[model samples]
Target: MTGKPIDGGAGVVSRVVDVADPADPRLDDFRDLNSVDRRPDLPSGKGLVIAEGVLVVQRMLASRFTPRALLGTDRRLTELGADLDGVDAPFYRVSAEVMAQVVGFHLNRGVLASASRAPELTVSQVLDGAATVVVLEGVNDHENLGSVFRNAAGLGVDAVVFGSGCADPLYRRAVRVSMGHALLVPFARAANWPGDLEVLRDKGFQILAMTPDPQAATLAEALPPRAGQPVAILVGAEGPGLQEHTMRASDQRVRIPMSRGTDSLNVATAAALAFYERDRLRTTVST
Candidate 1:
């Protein structure tokens, strides 16, 4: 269903279609979004990629994931403004009550963009010309995984690699939590677990596995010299950390210097610190 034109600002034109019926087939992609085991975006099921909130939707517009359609309130349509000018997706405007009924909950984010899952990339594809990358293992928490992607983008990590047991980075909450960086950041799942470490190694990346073990070399001591050398900062879930095999596979095992007796930082935070350290070292050497 097409929408009527709303008072979009100069350079912005918004199509606002009123969605009265919650069960309308046009809104099927957004229906029951909160269903625990039945959501359409589930990778094991319909495998759609959902971008929640205005920022995520904006990122979706900028990323490779092209939104098939958008469903939101009038306020959101206004908020989106010029961001939607060239966007090809339809905007299904609906009342708050009807939206809540369709989505199966009150979505304060007030907007969502759904897209079909794009084809997956391989390890080598993501690693091409990457000078800095973050490799994750056993990071099954969507929020933590999302935070890592956000940190990677802001701190200059070029790409992300998922080792075994990592969560689906495209999960709805993860995409929302990453501020949509998850959609933009290039990533690949390891086809052979720690075996892929050799691929990164052969590509000249210095793999530094992050660890809490106080005996490991500090980030300052482990990072490479500034000649634009390739580096991979490997991180694992909070408690288990990098598997022994993964650690053994890496070129170096590094630790962030911390106060005595303190626990390690969160996994994503730890990855950010490593990325920051790498950037800082590069800057210091360049100057």
Candidate 2:
């Protein structure tokens, strides 16, 4: 059945089309989301960014990515409310059964939006005017990567810079785990890996590489002294931490104080602590 014009939110009318067929060509962007080879979010494949659930979909609307199409049930459409007012894409209204059939899973969130990947920002672009940024290396775990974005957004990180061996931050799973903060936070890839770190240094950012080495200065000692200065907190993967050369690139090696003889923390947790300390110190200094 063809869609009728409806008040999507406030007084604005949204282009809502009723879609009953799971095989409809327009639904292709959201089809088989769980299929390993056919997932639209594969950076190596369709290169689309998929936002699932109402909250993430709202974030996507406010982000750099403009949705190409949206597929969701009527309940979700009403839940999205005014967020759809100015969106130019068609909202493919479907039944819950059809949504599950098209996406190949029962999405409890009941809504999804598909957008083409936005152009990547350069390291300099994200770092421009930034006071604090997080640099990551070899953090291939999607959930951990997402948590870093979420923490970065909440803890006053100005940007995120990816070094070598990092996963795509826009991957659907990463975006979901980040609670959509991955879409809102500015991030850029280091085109030159450790070499690009020189860009941060040249811009006057004091790079603090995170580690568990007992000899390293604690976060309290490392952050307060640099409170008013531009800083970059560098975190590596869970087990290996930063490479020796990467650690050498930093102005300081810092560790979170631990008890019970614990050697290290999860990459995301460690990053959160570092971010919080840096923010706290900066706040204290400013106030």
Query: Model 1 compared with the native: what TM-score?
Result: 0.92
lDDT of 2 by residue, 10-125 (tens): 35536888999999999999999989999999988999999999989999999999999999988888878767878899999999999999999899899999999889999999
Which residue pairs clash within candidate 1?
Answer: none
Highest lDDT scorer: 2
Candidate 1 lDDT over 103-151, as tens digits, reads 9999999998899988899999999978999999999999999999999
**Model 1 accuracy (lDDT, Cα):** 0.87
Question: Which lDDT values do the candidates have, in the order given?
Answer: 0.87, 0.91
Model 2 residue 190 CA deviation (Å) reads 0.6
Off by over 4 Å in 1: 1-15, 224-227, 281-287
Give the clashing pairs for model 2.
none
